[model samples]
Target: MTGARITVDYDAKALDAALSQAVAALDNPIDLMDAIGAVIEEAIDRRFDTASDASGSAWAASLRARQGERGGKTLTDTGRLRASISRAVSGSDVAVGTNVEYAAIHHFGGEIERPARTQVLAFNDAGRFQSRKDSRARRDGVQPIAIATIGATTITMPARPFLEIDTVAEADIADVVQDFLRKSLNT
Candidate 1:
């Protein structure tokens, strides 16, 4: 007699019950976002504190200090403390700008063959430079970097791929983005 192939079956009902219980224990999106926001706020506060030489000063104290010493203060260039935190949260090479659009994920044929990655780009506005000593004359200069924006977009992925959820809505993401701006401007 020829050997026959044998297959073993697992109980689907048991697996479903376990998965349901696990999902139930997961945190809601709002709660997760709030937690993230709190952490970000704390980091911003810390950076703001370190950037300023004097404690208890206003948020913009650091910027004012830099301006007083030099012609104009640049948050991106001079605010090392703020930059470090921003980089830590958003990742290195993240920057501020306008009219910038970046892809968070891309899929082929409605499914991802590879892992998803987030990309960020920035565009800055034009500006005119003026020196405190020479007030009347204007010179061409680079524009200040603005906050980068990220919006919601769907990306397809193959079955069993890792799941990524950004529970916060786009509006909320925009709000968090403003935190970086606030820190930069204040300092």
Candidate 2:
């Protein structure tokens, strides 16, 4: 839980007023925060499943997808990052997201530059070397280079925002507030 997190902070002044009034009427307002946290958690999970952002726009195709890799969803390699998302409710606030080290890079999009520690770096090219130089290699079938060496690199990741309450989620949260207010009045 040391990395980035999505804190539940409403920007709508009207919603803030409504939430304040509604919670003031309740004896235990933390329960309402807990409910809101659950809603956010569900929304984030949905975004992962649909490969969509908080705005409901589809996430940019991952590098693996562009390379013709199959059998896994974007941001879901091994499911560690997705499954790491959780909610923490404290007082009248809730924060939802993951402690994964790479969460911010994938969510916000950025460049990572790795300086060569040694004189050279080595690794298999996995047909990439041939694909770049020879179209024939692509048509015939790429031959995996046993070893390739390079120094330093920059990896760019595109933003795939998944940690905000969108319009739909805002409406849902408003409904939750209204319901809690109604219940408080009833009690």
Candidate 3:
């Protein structure tokens, strides 16, 4: 959020004058939504492509993505995060967000792990990682993962912002908004 411009306030007199001439501008909620969504989407995409996948935070560059043993994208896989990013447009508002559970932790550096090694077993019914539930981890109907209680293990993931705006992104957002308004008015 270092370079993000959160508020845009227009002079009341100037807004009134423009409103009269561009009455049709921003009339449709979808136009406004699309414009806003595009700005956020493109900004995220740029970060993902940059490999750093972040800005604003000094720690952003420290957490480089690591590849898994099987060449899988692992923790830094932007594919899942990219796919999860979404937008919603309502009559009065526009919203952009990511459904990834770890998105917030990645955006802001944090310490993770319970006081104790909660549950190392795979048979937790409601939690995220169900060992038995995974077909690949099951061997002849037996859980492939061993059930054991490990000691406290903490993990520190640095902030890798996929949803922050830099200076260029701020300008891009303004241009997109302006273009959308102009086109909407002309139509």
Candidate 4:
């Protein structure tokens, strides 16, 4: 013999058992994905209600609010953006978003540039630029005043991010996943 040879064989039955159970449990994760989606949606809705982001930081006030116009919550004027939010689950994947055209602008914040062909652009002025006298007039139920502006103007919109899951929401998701796994493994 050239040398003493040693041979050893290892059995992976235990590993296979554990893996097979997990694979079978997660074979179809549509329900799990839906549950996760719901958790995320709830967090987003809460953000809208609290006027805060996923990190629990308050969002910047809206232009209207800064202009001394009392109204409903920011980003909920008509509730279109919030109401348009929805979730779609496919297989093991889930997505949440809104189809509103202005959703991105509000979420990301950007500048809107309006160009005027003429030198001066005249339009009706409402609560935006009313003087104290004008305010008195308005308080007396007078009609809105007219105002003029020169050249192109850029309007900057601040970002009010609301499309994310917070730490609490993450904990909720973990609970959901654990519950799913526990139920799956039990069955």
Candidate 5:
């Protein structure tokens, strides 16, 4: 992938104009999602366009065509959006890490300390069942166990063996974009 950076100076007037346009476009949540998706799609197009010597407008048109081929469905429910964006941006699946741990318990044979640490790998985007794998424990007492992998975006951690495991209930696309922006800016 090309790692070229493009720096365009935005003066106060230009910034104000852009902000005014954005405010004017603000409507509902879905509209916001669509706008954000457009921005993301444009950014991806720009990177490729520069390397290929294609105009920005032409690149955007190509992206729109690609989006249409995929049914022009840019935004969906939070879960679906996560999967879609991950696939679109990375061209690969993305996974979120969830931690699972166990504690000391009283069993039939006196106090029993079960395997102390277990981490459950959960898919960040999908609701369907995926394949699972075992991960190496991060610590001496903690056992790293990952179950169910689905496209690297979603998974389920079985309740068995571990005393407690936390799962992601939702994904925030805005936060994801902010994080991406932060990382991109720093680099």
Candidate 6:
């Protein structure tokens, strides 16, 4: 007498369904670089606000004052410089910058010169020197600043940084990412 044995196989449909669900879950990943860029942009805008001194920032007051000064169509004009600022994102990378030429100089203190212009500094009676340029030179025993070459007009700039991330702002980045993920998952 011989005995018969029976074997059973399970279907792979359940496994395939689980894998497909996992793949679907991975389809929409949360991206928060855009939110970071937005926060940075807002900070920059706030730094450039043109409100009054007591009610607003000193930078805002100074910038507003500069609007009426000599530097028209210049990067020092808060409105134009603020407008020139832009943020970029690529995958997980992000960057914030300005198109204005003197933005770097403004953010970081530096000296700029007009090489084509000349200035004269003459010694006064008490061994002191008075510096004047072109038509404004003092006519009393005037002495030239340079003997052979023309002096470049120099202006020393103070640093005024408009883009910065503070502790509060830094801590909010994680919240931003989490919120983004939550909304994305909900959708």
- Residues 1-187 of candidate 5: C-alpha lDDT, one tens digit per residue: 4898887886998667656654444322343354344544443333332422122221112233346755432221122322332212222222321121121110011233334343354332344323233332333234433543334232222211111111211123555545544443343
The TM-score between candidate 2 and the true structure equals 0.68
Q: Give all TM-scores, in the order shown.
A: 0.23, 0.68, 0.62, 0.72, 0.17, 0.54
Taken over the whole model, the C-alpha lDDT of each candidate is: 0.36, 0.76, 0.64, 0.80, 0.33, 0.61
Rank the candidate models, highest lDDT first.
4, 2, 3, 6, 1, 5
Candidate number achieving the greatest lDDT relative to the actual structure: 4
Q: Pick the TM-score winner.
A: 4
Superposed model 3: Cα runs more than 4 Å off: 1-21, 53-75, 114-148
- Residues 8-81, model 6: lDDT tens digits: 88669965665665455445432467678877777666565532122243442244456766444223454677
Order of the predicted models by TM-score, top scorer first: 4, 2, 3, 6, 1, 5
lDDT of 1 by residue, 5-114 (tens): 88899999976765664444332234334545554444344434443212222223324456675424423335432333321224222222112111112101243344
- Any idea what lDDT model 2 has? 0.76
Q: Which whole-number lDDT from 0 to 100 does residue 86 have in model 3? A: 76
lDDT of 1: 0.36
Q: For candidate 3, give the lDDT.
A: 0.64
Clashing pairs in 3: none
Q: What lDDT is reached at residue 74 by model 3?
A: 26
TM-score for candidate 3, please give it. 0.62
Instruction: Work out candidate 1's RMSD over C-alphas.
Output: 21.7
lDDT of 4: 0.80
Off by over 4 Å in 1: 1-15, 25-27, 52-63, 66-187
Q: What is the lDDT of residue 162 in candidate 3?
A: 69
Candidate 5, superposed: residue stretches over 4 Å from native: 1-10, 33-172, 175-187
**Looking at model 2, how many pairs of residues clash?**
0
